[model samples]
Target: MIRGRFTIYLTLLALSVIFMLGFFKQMFVMDVHPYNKDPAPRGKEYSKDGDFDWGTAVKYNPKQKLLLKDTVENILHPIAPEFRIGDALPDTVVRQIHIATSWRSGSTFLGDLLNHNMGTFYSFEPLHFESLSMSTERRLDLMNNIFKCNFHNKEVIGWMKHASKGENNFLFQRNFRSFKICENLLPGKVSCYMDKFQSPICSMSPIRVIKTVRFRVKLAEEFLKNDKDFPHFKMVVLVRDPRGTMHSRSHHSWCSGEECINSTVVCENLEKDAQSAYQLAKKYPGKVYLLRYEDICMNPYEEVKSLFEFLKLPRSKGLDNFIQKHMFGKESKKHPYSTFRKSDNIYMEWRKTVDMGYIEKIQKDCSIPMKTLGYHSFSSPFDRDNFTISVLSKASESIWPKNLS
Candidate 1:
């Protein structure tokens, strides 16, 4: 009888493995192509469609293409510094600041805050050149040096100067035109880019803040690693709760006809990113600041004050008021484009919303780094071993029971 039972158990286990493999293979590999009966004219693959396809292309908005193109042009055709034939070069000292963050992590708000002060101008996502074009590393190196005042390469500087003139205005025009073409393309009515960078306020700032929100951390790492000679550069990393972040990201993914929660890649990537940011912060103590979204939302004034101090900027008028007005509060409604907006309301909501089973899986997979981020304990009943278990137990009694009923 014992022998017969063992054989049955082994057979069942083999079948179970096969079933799981097949299920996951189908879940991940199945492709769903959009059905556009009258296909719109294709520009460069992944380029902006001049003719709009209302149904299919709403989420794949290409407003940033103009900005990117202009940036490239600026690098290629920089204008010569205007100095009379034999005059000495003007001693203009320029400082560069890089604001790096994972997408949708309030880097925009931080950038706006900095732009409000002296010696700060906002450059949106200059690091995306790596994925957008070939020879990204070379371009990034040239641009980095040009901004740093160590740009001895006259050819590169001339190219950039020529590029900056009409390029900035051209980008603004393109983005505005694109927005008019499809009003629903971007969720926010006021393009913060338009509001912050285009106005008279932007012209007053002297220092430049390059705001980038690439999902990958390696992009910034590569730039920093390569440009060791660059001086007086500061990097600010903005982070948010992964649960809220992923929730918002998921909605955006769905609108774009992509799967968000289907893959565990984002969670995995964020864990790696957080660790990278933490390490960078540790390595460059004074130069790097890790700003958390939750902390910012909770006490906007305090956080903004700290940030201004870190950036060596003065406490400007209406700074606190601006933060208070925009800070995520109880009265705010969930943004149609981002579900994470809803999740933002619940502090530590991951414990409440995530399924106990999935939470256990994530905890098991990411325990080491999660603990490193102060999310775990060494002793007591709710230590690392029982952290998820305890959360699950509490959730089971208070959170999930009503839903099940």
Candidate 2:
């Protein structure tokens, strides 16, 4: 009987130890090797001869070219001294630009314009890999790693895959030609070694633009303030009129909730962002630029010229051609998210579509941001519908409110 009891106790203890060991291993693996699953093995006789259809649902302009062309030409442009963070950045360090804006703003168009410039490595929304479970610090860390081209980091490798693969293949649309080359080399195999190829290409570029609507200006300000790793940082805070943004967001079903379309919430965020942007601009001079979407739409050529001048990047013929093709080109059935805008006046279409009640609420809820950002609120249907009357006030020209200290 004593031996039986002792044996039972030992068995229970062994089972508990095994359970604990497995739990710890899982936690360790999640922390260290997040993407531990091995890709399926490819056949030894694999060849690119088949009529393997490239996956459908492609969005970018290089239509039907699943195998992206490798036309990346690197241009070494002089960095404007005013845009430097503090001390002179080393020649090896590239200009790091972060476009901080909210969804439905013209950030994609703005980002695409910059990406069209030669020698630019544009990383579109690295935060697409972000989870609600992740803390703010983790998101900032991921941005830092990606901005620095630290693709070799174990965790960042997982994030890069998430941000670039599957439906997110837009990463290869304009920039990342090197990554495209690596991806096509093996067609359907992991042997192309994307992880080994991305960092070198990204780092070799003379400029890296990280365009993200996921990050707020306050968080970006904190990133610039805290992260000492990058010195050649330039932040562009892009904002649009609340009415236009909300109207645009309404087109997408995913863009819902208080954070997405709520007039009060949207303007609150914009107000806060404006305050932060103003302070950042004052603190960091040419390092921070506040760009209004309406301003860009009003006069794209002038705005583009000012933008390029601010960054000290030379105005390239490619960018000029891109703007002409996308901004003024013929309209067609396009992906809802495509940067192709047939006319600049499309931004004003909201005035025709949005109901007066909603406009009233938006004007009421967003009054502070409206006033601060130089947007004119309509008191009546006549004011709202008057094509002769512009919603943009003259104060917007400065990109800063007069009262901002």
Candidate 3:
């Protein structure tokens, strides 16, 4: 008993010293810019066939992409030049990319694929912060804080408040790996690894890829312009056919037997998700990369290669080997997309498995988005439509937001 007490006392003493050191560095060395608490306007929500002129969605100037290289170089304040274990990063340059989608939509699979690349410091949905019970704008703001590395922000603080309280297991799970990967950059090895598992790719990586299925498409677009808050960013929206999506969700008994053998909310959300993704690609020409789940499943190599090029990441042989191994390996089922079967068969499984009536309804509700995403009707399942080559995109520009302007 005395030994245990002595151990506890020493631990406390060590932590106290570390805390003081952090405080000393904060006051005398590192440049401390006050965190921005100014709330940004809530982004426009997704709504299809509405009276709004924005029509499904519109594009940013490709020239605007250059702004990513700009950063706040001159902080005209009294501060010392110093380098710490984890230095403050510049808020410019294309350093972070996000794969945003909805639940059960192959996000986890895509995240796994990105993690296969050594160049990418991949985090599996750090912003999948399930406890932030605030407004959507507030949630986006908190998410911005996370990407900005503002660990002390109220929203971030609350999410990880229990982290130090013997909750290493909780942190490693529940989409907190992204936060912990960043923690690897922080000082002190004992506190981070004393009770937790560290990500293998925690070494100094230039690119950071975080995947989240929480935010809608419109909200993601709003951040395209808010660089001061979000910094250098690129986003990809992963979309799967509504039938396939419903089929995947209905695998569990609780999620089936409502609208189209899945709940009404499920069906409705699928349509909304498609529209949201469609709208973003339509409006933000070079801003958002909309990837179809079918395309990835059909040709994971080509599709992922295209995305890597878009994100300007070099082709990684490690990623190629990972995909090759998973494509044929009998890896026990973990992700929705990972299996012994080829991804080609996974894309069109819904057509053969789901009811014909359900397919028609999903197609009807999501026709534009379906067509926009290269998904065809029951009448033409083999057509394999492509959105980027469609005239619909050109037509969409005419309906751009005009009334207020």
Q: Which candidate's TM-score is highest?
A: 2
Better of 2 and 3 by lDDT: 2
User: Model-by-model lDDT, in order?
Assistant: 0.43, 0.65, 0.50
Candidate 1 structure lDDT: 0.43
Better of 1 and 2 by lDDT: 2
Across 326-367, the per-residue lDDT of candidate 2 in tens digits comes to 888885226777888865687788999899999999989988
RMSD of 3: 17.4
Q: Where's the lowest-lDDT run of ten residues in candidate 2?
A: 68-77
Give all TM-scores, in the order shown.
Answer: 0.50, 0.74, 0.60
RMSD values, in order shown:
22.5, 17.8, 17.4
Q: Which rank order by TM-score, best down to worst?
A: 2, 3, 1
Residue 347's C-alpha lDDT in candidate 3? 57
Candidate 3 residue pairs that clash: 58-283, 59-283, 59-284, 374-385
Error of 1 at 107 (Å): 2.5
Cα lDDT tens digits, model 3, 246-301, are 76877766443353354455546556766765566566555567676766666778
lDDT of 3: 0.50
